[model samples]
Target: MSTAASEPEETTVKQADQTETPLESLASICTVLAIGLFVMTFIFQNYKIPSGSMEKTLLIGDHVLVDRTSFAPPTKWAPFVHYRDIHRGDVIVFYKPNPETPDLFLVKRAIGIPGDRIHLVNGIVYLNGVAQNEPQAGKPVEDGNPQHAFDAYRDDFPSVPPPPYEIQPLGITASWALDLPNHIQNGDLVVPPGMVFAMGDNRTESEDGRYWGFVPRQNIVGRPLFVYWSFETSADQMSKTSLGDRLSFIGHILVHFFDETRWRRTFHIIR
Candidate 1:
């Protein structure tokens, strides 16, 4: 009986059966990276809260999905996108002006829009010379401090005097002091075009526009669409970036992911 002849592997069959050529491997990686970059650069991006600056609205460890296109300008290369202007009371995510903390993105309320006049007294905000109808600002907090219950700059806007509380921080609040006369008209801080005056929901604890300066139109990344996940982590733990601390945090997440998750906060919209 003649044995069946051994089949010789064809060159085409070998090429097709190869896991992938070097170029193809690179192509696959590039495709994945490109998609990720595109999503991060244009459509959506993630942000995490490391502090209680935004408090009840956005607590520490609240992971948010920010819609980058929400404020994206019309582009010639892309489709005709009708992006709306930023609105007052909208919660926005932006890069903190402090260059030292480049990765520190802060979440705050868009209290004053372009060309709007803003005034705050004892943490009570006034918009366009009228008391703002702010449900978020009025949001009750659990702060127990009675004295200095509001904030330091309660009486020092429009004509931001040398900060009475201490050496004025070299921030927007300081700039306002230098450009005091120009920025003030009728005793209200007039938000210049392409700049917004931002504040935190937990006004007393936040170091926002009242401490620093305006959030430049470009620094406004996007408004958070919703809280995708919220883990019960403290500000101290969230702020620690050491290797040991990070590993510990990761271990904690792995062990208590389900137990620590703020299930009620998931999908909670950011105003």
Candidate 2:
């Protein structure tokens, strides 16, 4: 009688330890996925560096994760979260602030904030009458190399009025060309309220604020936090928009993923 009683208790324990049913497992997976989707949609987002505008700092194919909460407006729901206004020198991702490219997003470093006076001399940024020491900023070497030769209009900035759009080598938009003059005061470009002056680290290659216009505060997105992954990619690869080209690139990535990946840049923090 005692042995039989013990056997029934062992059977009960085994039944209780049985694995979850298929439906239960599926539900668990869905719950996890929903949480992950929420986090990615609201808290963090990822962006890829498609151009060399921010070269040396952010290379082409560098995939970075951006924190969306830092520069976002305060909300009572998440009062505990820390939020702050964008500061000078912060790398920002924002809409191009151009009617022609309304949907385009560009990444650049904030050089001027509201009320700040800005100018450039020989490609060096002069913020509020003092030359900023920006070690990351890149300019073409003055070795008479025509391809990398300096441009007086780009290097000198507002000091040299942008040439007519028809003959302009620099990518200065016509609207910006007209509006840029209104902001200049005593040779300094005064940033108006709710506007930011931004430029790429690679000054020679970037078509940034000098080319377009001030980034509206409303158009400002969050700053990048770190490079999650990077792979060797061509500068013009992003221009190929065909379905076949995208699929071909996907195949190439799969084949060369291990070898082509920039392992050193993985998880590299963005300043």
Candidate 3:
């Protein structure tokens, strides 16, 4: 009968509605976000290739889906192997070089393990006194000639010229790079404990441990599982005419919109 009594009922209804709305909204949002995070973290993680370091094996612009759980704890049915036992030839992704500027990730093949002695002779990789049989090595190549020549020149003529410039340009040539009595001798470089040597399949183009030093085992993220998708950019994607060719700069961009190689490399396996 009193108007005040009706006011209390309305207030109670309003409080109940407010509480129910937030709970319902929160539950819905949490369910969707949980599923998305789980899919991205455990099932599949996406990666984009930034360089040709692993060319022919993994091309630029290739989008790969790494199985996060592949090396993780095995299922109850199969529990023998673990991620700790990483073997050679595994394509692994790890934190990029330069700890201060650590955003981009790198992918390379495991070449040498802890306690392994690695040396290069005439562009051939000898591991532990045995020539490694690299079925996937595209072509054998070598670097570090200038360093060797400079060292030799310093030993012979310690007072002539200086540290680096003393070595002549011809000394850096591949044919004459290791031309010393002890040049072909094997230099035993033991792999430091808990470190692994990684090299790219495209040996000539890779800046790996052979240049920058060994990759500590902690930096390793996971092994590459599969190539999920690939997008190939056509030659026209770049400026076709540099004021000399037939096509105009604007014309090339217009043509490239339709000239993209969309399906040539999709779903290809990362060998």
Q: Who wins the TM-score comparison?
A: 2
Clashes of 1: 2
Summarize candidate 2's per-residue lDDT along 36-69 as a digit string, tens digits: 9988888898999999999889999999998888
Candidates 2 and 3 compared: the better one by lDDT is 2
Candidates by TM-score, descending order:
2, 1, 3
Instruction: List the lowest-lDDT window of 10 residues for candidate 1.
Output: 1-10
- On lDDT, the leading prediction is 2
User: lDDT tens string, model 3, 1-271?
Assistant: 7997799999989998777577799999999999999889865689977667787788775778775655454578546545455577788887754455376588898877888776655444677888778766544423554332223222221112222324454222222223222222245556768878777876655656554456777777777666666665333433443665545534654676446534566677665
- Number of colliding residue pairs in each model: 2, 0, 0
Stretches of candidate 3 above 4 Å error?
1-29, 70-84, 140-186, 234-264
Ranking by lDDT: 2, 1, 3
lDDT of 2: 0.91
Against the true structure, candidate 3 reaches a TM-score of 0.60
The superposed Cα distance between candidate 2 and the true structure at residue 187, in angstroms, equals: 0.5
Pairs in steric clash, model 1: 172-212, 172-213
| C-alpha lDDT of candidate 3 relative to the true structure | 0.62
Question: Deviation in angstroms for 205 in model 3?
Answer: 0.8
TM-score of each: 0.80, 0.93, 0.60
